[model samples]
Target chain A: MFTLYEFASSGNCYKLRLAMAQLDIPFQRIEKDITRGETRSAEFLAINPNGRIPVLVTPDNRVLPESSAALWYLARDSKLMPEDPFQQAQVLQWMFFEQYNHEPNIATSRYWIHVLGEQEKYAEALAEKQQKGHDALAVMETHLSDRDFFVGRDYSIADIALYAYTHVAGQGGFSLDAYPAIRGWLERVERQPGYVAMEA
Target chain B: MFTLYEFASSGNCYKLRLAMAQLDIPFQRIEKDITRGETRSAEFLAINPNGRIPVLVTPDNRVLPESSAALWYLARDSKLMPEDPFQQAQVLQWMFFEQYNHEPNIATSRYWIHVLGEQEKYAEALAEKQQKGHDALAVMETHLSDRDFFVGRDYSIADIALYAYTHVAGQGGFSLDAYPAIRGWLERVERQPGYVAMEA
Candidate 1:
């Protein structure tokens, strides 16, 4: 069994829970409210000095943080991880793209506009984020136009990683109407077995 | 042999070169000058739609982008990667931290202040980047205070990934004087066999 410390609404945390569900791994969830300053508390800091949520405490009592890392751990030997060395690297490439290119823009915009409701205060940043978020979506749209999945023609954690914030991107003020391929790909992800939607 | 498309001065590109040296892997290098807009060319975009340097083309003609993912690929079967699953996840955790936390602040600051010399132009963002970069260093200091490396009691790709930008963080106006543990850890990394320095 694993113990996951997370924020229920966070896409980063949702990535882990959704991966575990797909992999059929049993884990306990401990919710931390970031908006209430819970993640910054001393107790949570002890679990992850970085003070981020979606940390996994393994059956052996080892603490693992970083949502994508947890996904890789849970799906390592499963069909979710590609076996070919190059394909494995490709999976990681998209995962990194999600963090570096996609999440910072899409997720941050969603946080400011939807969760925090501080869109006015964050107007300047949000404007820049929206442009970059669309750039990220365009890249995904181009890639998905020729493929069924991100790697190896199968639904892998790369899909899950990118899907987390992307599905809720509308709340961030991004329109999916311009991205036909990404829209089709999102539906393909939803149809995966044992899939769990991000909780409200 | 592998073919690497990179910018010689970028810490992100240096990461792959350094890792290959440490692992004794030989690869051909193709330099792309980002300042000259070489990465944005149609040819480069055909190789990686992301239009980023540090892309690796495998012998089998597979194109892989993203520095840390390429590091994982080259080091997966080597001593640079942990054999244990939990330790592997730990390695991935720090790699993710390097990408999501450390690199964005440290590397971007370096580019603005050192490479582009745009400190005044990016004054507002630079100020925030400096604070976040220091916070990232503090986390590394606290962690290194108790350990020699990021994971499994050995130097792994996690160290390589973080070390790429961190050793040069001073160029970004980040002082290393307060981070004695991180300074010592940097020296420890330099002492590893087959080590290579980031090019000027």
Candidate 2:
């Protein structure tokens, strides 16, 4: 059994949950409120010194931290991970983009404008955030326009990674009106077998 | 043939270079000056719409972005990527930790303090960076204390991902004296076949 320590609102945490559901891998969930700093507790720190959510405790007592890492673990050797070298690399390429470009812009903007409630204070930053966020989305919109999935023409961890935040990007104040391709792709991912909503 | 668009000082780019050298895979190198914003140019962005350096272009003109992703591509079906399901996840787990905890801290700190010398401007954020950077180093120090490599007791992409930035962490105004374990691991990575210096 895998025990997951997560925050329900976190896209990173959601990545793990969605992947586990896709694989039909049974796991336990322990929620942590990052805003209140529950992750800093001594007990939690012992498990993950980084004190972040979505830490997966394996059956063998090995604790794995990081959401994408957990997803990679759950989908390992499964259909979620591509068999070909180039296709596998394609999955990772998008994952990296999620972290470096997409997440930083879209996820950060969403956190600031919606969750933080300091939109005015962050207005200037938000403008840049939206632009960069859209830039990332635009790239995705173009790529997804012609493909059913991010790589290998099959659903993979890359979709799981990008889907987590993208589905709720509007909550972060990012309008998806222009990204019809990405929107369609999201529907495709949502329809995957064993799919689980973030709130679910 | 693989053509890598990279910057000499970037740890992310260095990871790909190091891996290629280790595998004795020859590839053409196209150095980009990130500081000059070469990555944002139309030509470069065409290769990688994300406008990021370390984009790997295959013979077929397919462009793959992200350093870790590029490493995955080069290592796919090779010995560098772990074969076992659990072990591969372990590798990814560490890689994700590097991005969220380690890279954001150590790598960002190095860039701000050493490369840009904007410590005063980032002073308010400096304390947080310092704390997080030190904390990330602590995790690496402890992990390396017990293992020769990040996963499976052999050099893999995990080591390659981490070694890229850590070896030059000192260049970012971080001291190596506090991390003897990491220093020792650095030596081990250096001694690996086809070890390439950061500036090389």
Candidate 3:
């Protein structure tokens, strides 16, 4: 069995859980509390020197960190990935957008405002993050305007990566009112086979 | 031939230029002036809705944006990628670390100080970035202290993704004096066959 080390409430970690469910991959999860700095513990650092969670330890004992990397590995030969090489790169394109442009802004804001109850403490910073998170949503909305998914005409890990945080963006103070296309895409993603919610 | 849209001074853009040179892939360069806001223009936005440079336009006219994705595309079947599945995911782990942790701090500080000459204007922000950037450098130092390359004992796109900004981290005011391992690894990346300077 695979062993997934994660923070249950973190969408980055949730990406692995959702992907595992959809792919029918069996894994045992070990929760790490980020609030208490468990991820930064010396023992945790040994597993990932950079000290982040959502790491996957395969049945063979190989360690893989980073939610995107873990998702890619799980989806590699499954129906979750694209067959075309160019489409595969497009998948990476959206995933990179999620990491670089989406998650940092959306997830960070949520962590501060919702998870840490620091809405007022980080008011100034939250305002800035809120604007950028909307920009990221706008990009996603425009992309999903003409297509059902982010990449070719199918559901892929790209959707899973972006959906992890986007579904709960209100926790970051982002409203989906302006992004009908993105909302529609989110529904389509939820309806995919064996799709699991983060709370699970 | 590939048509590479770039802001030449950006290491993110340089990742593509350097990768193309190493792969012996011929490409025409279309320089975009980011300072003048060219990337955000409607035409460029049509090319990449995210409005970022280092976008690759294939000979067949397929447009692929995001430097990491383009590098993965160009290196997919080449010696630049690892044949092992787990090792390939390790490449993504480091690349995500570059985008999320390293670039935002290191490259942003470089842009504020080295490129924009706004050192004093953004002094406070730069200081925080400097600390975080060093943290990123320290992680690279420890990782490289024992390994020759990022994954599977061979130089891969993970190196190119990281080497783009890391080798020039000094411009970001991050002194590598304490990171001899990182310096040595930089030299190793420089010696790879078909490697070309960023300016070319």
Clash statistics: count for each candidate: 0, 0, 0
lDDT of 3 by residue, B1-200 (tens): 99999988999999988888889999999999888999999998999999888899999999999999999999998889999888899999899899999999999998888888899999989987877888888899999999898888999999999998888888889888999998999999999998887752
On the 0 to 100 scale, the lDDT of residue A131 in model 2 is 79
lDDT of 2 by residue, A138-166 (tens): 98998887889999779999999999889
lDDT of 3 by residue, A50-159 (tens): 88898899999999989998999999988999999999999999999999999989999999988898899999888888778989999999999999998899999999
Stretches off by above 4 angstroms in model 3 are none
What C-alpha lDDT, on a 0 to 100 scale, does residue A15 get in candidate 2?
A: 91
| lDDT at position B144, candidate 1 | 94
Q: What's the true lDDT of residue A53 in model 1? A: 86
Given the true complex, what DockQ would model 1 score? Answer: 0.89
Model 1: per-residue Cα lDDT over B28-106, one tens digit each: 9999999899999999999999889899888877889999899999999899998998899899999999999999999
Ranking by TM-score: 1, 3, 2
Q: How does model 1 fare in lDDT?
A: 0.92
lDDT digits (tens) for residues B1-200 of candidate 2:
88999988778888888899988888999999887899989988778877877888888778888888788778866778788777787777777777766787778877777777797887776677777778888988988888899998788899989888888777665787999999999899889888888873
Report how far off residue A191 is in candidate 2 (Å): 2.6
**What are the per-model DockQ values?**
0.89, 0.71, 0.91
Cα lDDT of candidate 2 equals 0.83
Cand. 3 Cα-lDDT? 0.91
Model 2 residue A56 lDDT score: 90
